[model samples]
Target: MQLAAIREARAAKVAEARRILATAETEKRSLNPAEQSAFDKFKAEITSLEADEQRATFMEDCERRALGDPVGDRSFSAVQRQVNVVEVIRAQMEGRSLSGAAAEFAQETERRTGRKAQGVFVPLSAIESRAVNTTSTAPELVPTIHRADQYIEPFRNSLLARRLGVRVLSGLSGNLSIPKHGTGTTVGWVAENAALPTGDMSFDGVTLAPKHAGGITEQSRQLIMQSSPDIEQLVRDDLSFMLAQAIDSALIKGGGTNEPVGVLSTSGIQTASLATLSWQNVLAMLQKLDIVNASAANIVASTKAKAKLAGTLKAAGIAGYILEGGKVGDLPAYFSNQVAEKTGTPNTGRVIAGDWSQVMLGIWSEVDILVNPYAEGAYSKGNVLIRAMATVDAAVRHPEAFVVADDLAI
Candidate 1:
């Protein structure tokens, strides 16, 4: 009898442990040992299954009150079902004598699957960002300005029209050529037999006169004449507006300052000037004014300059340099090759190239300094318009004298 009681006690303990595991598995898919310990402690306090039901009901009532809901009784019923399933499984695991129904259910599950079911929980990192300062003064709200004249809304409408016209003209021109005939076809026979050939069969000058006369007609001349002023104005205005915006933004971000005072100079190669660049001078100028990130561009230039300037800048811990030209394509091959080599490696820095307008736009948009070897004739009035479009809001810090901004707003 004493031995039987000991076996019953051990079975009870095992059953209780299984019940605790089941509750934890239902609440969370998995628990670490610490979390499992908390569940076991709670389970140990319950004197009977009725006590467990009462505790669960009370907890359900509390949750319903906290959530301000009317379904506390239904929630408790669900919790009871979960508790019952866990307790029954625990009892079977502990070697207790199960009821016929419980024994049959356990046997059926064991027959279907030899392994016990388990739950798993995956861990994740918490994402975070800088908190907003509630105590700071409110930012001043700027009113949105709407243009009064729809027709004169910069290049808005004209740009689309110009693009459409170009597309149509290109499509028409594409269809103007004659289609190729298949093999073994002579030019004279193909011209005569072709379905859509311009019939000019006779080789005599008198017979060809009519076809030549048609080419010289006013209608033919009108086709070329029709495409002049509107197209020209459209391109001019679009370029003008874009450049203006780039320069304006650059000036604003670069602290609304005038161009730096110095003779706008250029090196046939940026590497050639690397030795002469004074870091102290550049840093002093940067400190005196608000210049955005300059190190990247400087570093790129240094790299392109190779040992000549890169080593100096790297030793001084200077970070960036700028290249001047209209397009990335326009940069000298030697400089570009050097830049490509250093990209993504440890001694990397930003390299930029553009005409004044493009570089300036890049500066304003990227909040970086515009770098380029200065050139005067590189931006004539017409080309300046194009450059301005390219750089719109960036500061045009080129040394050359050009109208950087439109005094009269378009």
Candidate 2:
């Protein structure tokens, strides 16, 4: 019988035994010979059912172990018995899922967490033992593995997105606006006692709404099954880099349709026109900024523009513009290929100088991922497509804090 069926039968037998015992108690007498025989039969059936149940449970546990998975409770001991940590880590490094039992460990973790699972499931004692062994000999693998830091550039290092001031939001979407204080009535100064004129504070609303940014990555089933574990991380990093750059681009040069209004598009920001990038031009843009904004400003330009600026600095022998250690003076300089390299008839490059703090970036907390097994191209290659998407928005709180040096020689 199935486990459920067996359990149900055992329950019925237990109930019968209880009924027999209760009847004798109600009569306030020992069971008669016939009643005693009936009681004994019920007891025998319940005992047999209990043994069957135990055997079923044992069989289930054995199957779970064979599958390299933990049973219902997901306890530590159960995990330890079913997973091989070393094999799991090796599988990850190769950009492939572990076959056989090791794969089960990943599956179980993903089932519980509803996210991609990485790493192993070894006990602390086992890790300590491994550490001890590794300490005596040259470590089998270095403690750290280095990869290109692509994702960090746009969001982690971008002037507008990271260094500049921004208010972070957790929700998927919402409205945001800045308040404007009303001017108090300018009453002429009176000797000591006239009641101060009253004025009302007015608010202006700047609606903040998030737009979607996302991309899809497709890999062959054969590659997933045969490749090394680093492939997974590679895909993850690439997706993140793609989204980060997109959002960063929108923040700098977006047309303000579906995307955020970029710094270049904001009204009333200071501007400088220069035919070529020069130290004096950069300094002029800096000077045009409000003193408050200049205190915390950063410079952002395209790689081409940075190269041009560096050349000009070298020609002029301006050591200050050399950008040693990635900075020029007190301002940190960043390069983004996304910034427009040329615009208008003269084909001018652009440089943005601003206090990033005046820009606000809002994002939904989690990136939504969907795995598709039957996408059009995926079907032919026996592969799957993993698409990641996020919702975000950006707004400038004060345009006066920014200056754009456009019409620069490219």
- Where does candidate 1 have its weakest 10-residue lDDT segment? 206-215
TM-score of each: 0.14, 0.55
Best of the candidates, lDDT? 2
In candidate 2 the C-alpha lDDT for residue 261 amounts to: 79
lDDT for position 190 in model 2: 58
Q: Report the backbone clash tally of model 2.
A: 15
CA-only RMSD, every prediction: 40.8, 25.8
TM-score of 1: 0.14
Give the range of the ten consecutive residues with the poorest summed lDDT in model 2: 127-136
- Report lDDT (CA) for all predictions: 0.27, 0.57
Off by more than 4 A, model 2? 1-160, 163-166, 178-201, 225-229, 276-280, 291-294, 313-325
RMSD of 1: 40.8
Candidate 2, residues 126-179, lDDT tens digits: the string is: 121100001012357766443323323223333235434444443333355545
